[model samples]
Target: MSNITRPWWKDAVVYQIYPASFHDSNNDGIGDIPGIIQKLDYIQSLGVEVIWVCPMYASPQIDMGYDISDYEAVHPPYGTVQDMEVLIKETHSRNMKVILDLVINHTSDQHAWFKESQSSKDNPKRDWYIWRPAKYDSEGKRGPPNNWRSFFGGSVWQWDEQTQEYYLHLFCTEQPDINWENEEARKAIYQSAMTSWLEKGVDGFRIDTVNMYSKPMDFPDAPVQDPSTPWQDASLIFCNGPNMDKYLDEMNAILSRYNAMSVGECPATPDRARVIRYVSAEAKKLNMVFQFDSVDVGQSKPSKYDTKPFNYTLADVKGAISRTQSLLDGTDAWTTSFIENHDQARSVSRFGNDSPTFRTRSGKMLSMLFASLSGTLFIYQGQEIGMINMPKDWDIAEYKDIDSQNFYADALARNPGNKAVKDFAKAGLQHLSRDHARTPMQWTAASPNAGFTGDKVKPWMRVNTSAQDGINVKDEDADATSVLNFWRSMLKVRKNHAEVLVHGTFQLVDENNEKVFSFVKTSLDGKDKALLVCNLSDEENRVPEFEGVELAEAMLLLDNPWEGRIYLID
Candidate 1:
C-alpha cells in the first residue's frame, strides 16, 4: 500500500446539532444560534472537532429547516445573522470547525425568487424553477404533467393558477425544486448563496439531498409498482441524474477555491461503487458521503413508512457495517460513521436496548463501534448521553415533523374506516417517527422546560421525560461510568490514534459470530493494530479467542457487556 495524505476533516469527528432542539436562549421556546454559542464549552468537552449545525436559515418551517427560504440569512427564531457570525467565530476560537447544513435541492415557495417566478409565465425568474404545462386527458380534464409523487406524498407537480403552469416540488408543496438545467439559476445558487457562506469562514457544508439536484430533461411518468409508495424507487429519475457530475464539478470548483470540505447527504441504493464515485479524490465532488445502508436496514420493501417487524437480527447489522467497510477500505472516498441524526430515531432505541438496565451499555457499545471505524464519526446532539426514542404512547398531536404528519394523513385517507391502516400508521409512528429524534434536548433535570428554555416558555418540541429522570447532561456529566463519559473517552482514543482509526485498514474478525461483532484496525504504517470487540446481545457472551492472537499482553479499552474491549494487538 502507498502512503496517502489525509485531509483535516478525515481525522475529525462531527457532532450534529438540530438547531431547533438544541437549546433555547432568551426564553424564546425555540433554540437559536445564540443558544448553541452558550453551549460551546459543553460541546468542546465532548472531543468533537466539527459542529454540524442543521440549517438555521430562514424558512416557513414546512419540513423544518430543510425548506430553505433565505440561504444567506438566519431564521428569525434562530437569532439574527449576527448571531450566526458569532457562532462561527466562537466555534473557531475553541479550535473547532463549523459545518453548516446547506439545502440547495429546493427553496421555500415563499422565497422572493419563487414568488416572482410564479407571478407570470414570462417572468424573468420563471425559468429559475421547474415549470411545465398541465397535461389534459381526452375529456380535457387537467392533471399533473407526470405520475411523479412528492416525497411527502401526492403529486410532485403543483399547479399555479396564475401562471397556468405546474412547478415541480419533490418535497412539500411549499418547497419548489430549483431548475438546475437553467444556467442562470445554477450560477445564482453557486455564486450568490454558496459563495457568500464560504466567504463567511465556515469550514464546510453538509449538502442536503445533494444527488437530487439534477432532473432528466424528458419528464417520464413513474410506473406504479407499489401502491404504498409509488415514488420510493423513483430516485433514479432525480437522484444522480445525467448532469449531477457536471453540477458537482462546478460546486467543487467553488469549494476547492476556499479549501473547504463538503459532505454530501446522498441517499442512493446501497451500492458502494455508486457512492465512491461521488467522493473519490479524482471525482473532485465531495469530501465524504453519508450512505443510508445502516439506517435503512429493516425498511420494508417499496416504502420506508410501512411498518415491518423490528426483528432485525445481528447478521443484518454486521452485513451492513462490514460491507461498507470492506468496499471503502482502500478507496479514496471516505464514509460517514453515524448511527443517528436529525432524520432517524435515536440509535440506542433503534439498534440497542433503551431500557433503564442496558441504555448506557448499549449506547456505549454503539459509540465504540462507530468510533473505531475507518472514517469520520458523527455524534448527534443528546447521543453522547444515550438519549432514547420519544416516550411511548405519545399521541400524534405531540408530533411536529411534516413527514410523520403527511404519512399519517395519507394512510388514513387511503383506507378510511379501516382499523388495519390506522394500526399500521400508529405502529410506524411508534418505531419510525422523525419526531423521535427531533424532541427537545434535555440539558437539566429540573424545571418546566428541562432547562432548555426559561420557566415561562414551552419548548417547541416535547423534552423526553425519561431524560430528565436519569439521562440529562447534568446527571451524566457527574457519573464516571455514564455513556457521556464513555463517548468522551472513545473520542479521545480515536484522536490519540488518528492514524489507525481514521486512515487505517479495516478487517472484520469472527465474521460468522452472531453474538459478537469485532474487527481489527491496522495503522497505515502497520506498526500499531487495535482489535475492537463487542457483545451484540444483551446476555453475556465470550469473545472468540483467536488462534494467533494473545490477550494477556493486550490493553483492555472498555470492560462491559455492550462495549466489550479494544486491545493493542501484538
Candidate 2:
C-alpha cells in the first residue's frame, strides 16, 4: 500500500539464491560468485525479474555470511569485489536486477570496528557497540547486565575480557550488535557501505534483522514468558525499538536517491499498523517487508526450536493469507508474500505432501496457490524443481547448520538421559530445521555431486539424494509435465493476467470451504475478474456454484485429484 506514484517492484518476481549451496564453479566444494555467473542463463530462464543473493560479504563463516567482517569486500570463497561488479553488469545485461543481502544489525567480532570497540573502555570507538559492566548478584556472583537472551540461546551479552565489559550480540557470540544510537557509527555505515554498493549499480538490499537495530535506552529485562526458559522471548524489549522509524527514515533518504527496491526482514513487526508505517509509500521507509505470520502458522511458541510439533490446519493457511490481505487492501503498505526462503524448511515438505505418490501433484497445487496471491512472489532456490527435505535416514552429524546444531545440543541438556529428548530434537529437525533448505542445489542426476561441483569433489553440504533418482533441473527442464515446467507455466499465467493477480483487489470467495482455498481477484475498475480455486486436501473436490457468475470453460491449471482452476466470471 505504498503511496509512491511509481512502484516498479510490484511486477517483479524474486528468486533467492543461497550462494554457498547454489553452484561451486571452482570445484572447491563451496559455491561462489563465479559459479553464479555461470548459472545466469539458467536463472534468467526461470522468468524471475530480480535475484536476491544471500550474504556473500567477507566473514569468518561463524553464522555463515551474516557475520560480516568487511562491508565493502566479498568473502574469499565467494569471490572479489571486481567479481561483484561483473555480476551486477551481467545481471543488468540480462534485464534482471540484483539485490545483495545487507547485514548491518551486527558485525563479526573480527571486524575492525568491533575489534577497536572491544580494545578498551576508553577507546575512541568504544561507543560504536552496545557495552555494559557486569552486574553482581546479592550473593556476589557476577552475571550479564540484563536478563536478555540470544536468539540462538544463552545470554545476549558476550563478555570482553580485555575491556572488562560485555558486548551485545542477539545472535552468535561472534556477531556483536552495533549501536545505532551513535550518530558517528550510523553515518559511517551509510557512507562507507550502503552508498558504496549503490554506486556500484546494485539494485537495493534485503536488510537482515531490520527491526533489531534500535535497542531500548535502558537495556531492560524482557517479560519472562517461562521462568524455566527465561530467555525465550526477549524480543519484547529489544525488537522494534523507539527509534526504528528515525533510523529507517535515515536509510530511506539514501535509498530514495537511487529509487532502490528495498525489502526488509521484519519478523519483529507483526501488527498491520506498525508494518504499514515502515512500508507506506508516503513514509518512504521501505518498498516491502517480509513478515512471519503466514510462515509461523503451525510454528511452536516460545521458540521455533521448541519440542512441540507443527500441526497447522488448512483453515489456518486460509486465515493467515485472508487476514493479511484484508489489512493491506486499501493502504499503501504491500505484502511480500512467500512460501519458503533460506531460513525456512521447504514449503513442499511443510505445507504439502512430499511423498512420492503426491509430490508432483502437491508441488503443482502449491505453485498455483502462490501464483494466485495478489502480491510479489518470491521463489527460493531449488523450489522450482520441487526439492524436498533431507533424507530421513541422515544422522545429526551430517547437518552443518550452526543454528540447528546449537538447538539440538541445548534440547539434550534440558532433558538429560531421557530418550524423549532425542525424539523431541529429531522432531524439530524434521519439521523446522533451517538446514533442510540449505542443501546443495540439485542440477543434474547424472553428476557425482549433482553437477553442483566437479565429479571428484564432495559438496560442502550434502545434496538431496533424490536428485540422483529424478528430482533435478536437467530432467525437469526436459520433461513437459515436470515441476519446473509447471512453475514456468504458473509464472506465465501471473504475467499474462498481471492486472488481476498483481494489481487487483483480493477477496476470499469460499471462506468457509475447509478443503479449498478459493479467492477472486477483480481489476481496480471491476471490468476484469478472475477466480482462483485450489484443493487444499488430497481428496477430489467439486467446485461449488456461485450465485451471480456463469461458469464457462474453466482454465484447468492443475488436473483432477489435485484440483486447481481459474475462471473468468462475467
Which lDDT values do the candidates have, in the order given? 0.84, 0.84
The window of 10 residues in a row where model 1 has the poorest summed lDDT is 300-309
Estimate, for each residue in 329-446, the C-alpha lDDT of model 2 and write its tens digit: 7897777778899998888888877888888877888888787677778899999999998877898887788888888888888988888888878788877888989999999996
Tell me the TM-score of model 1.
0.96
Q: Per-residue lDDT of 335-445 in model 1, one digit per residue for the tens?
A: 778889998988888788888888889988888888888888888999998988877778778878888888888888989999988888878777777888888898888
Candidate 2 is scored at a TM of: 0.96
lDDT value, candidate 2, whole model:
0.84
Estimate the TM-score of every prediction.
Answer: 0.96, 0.96
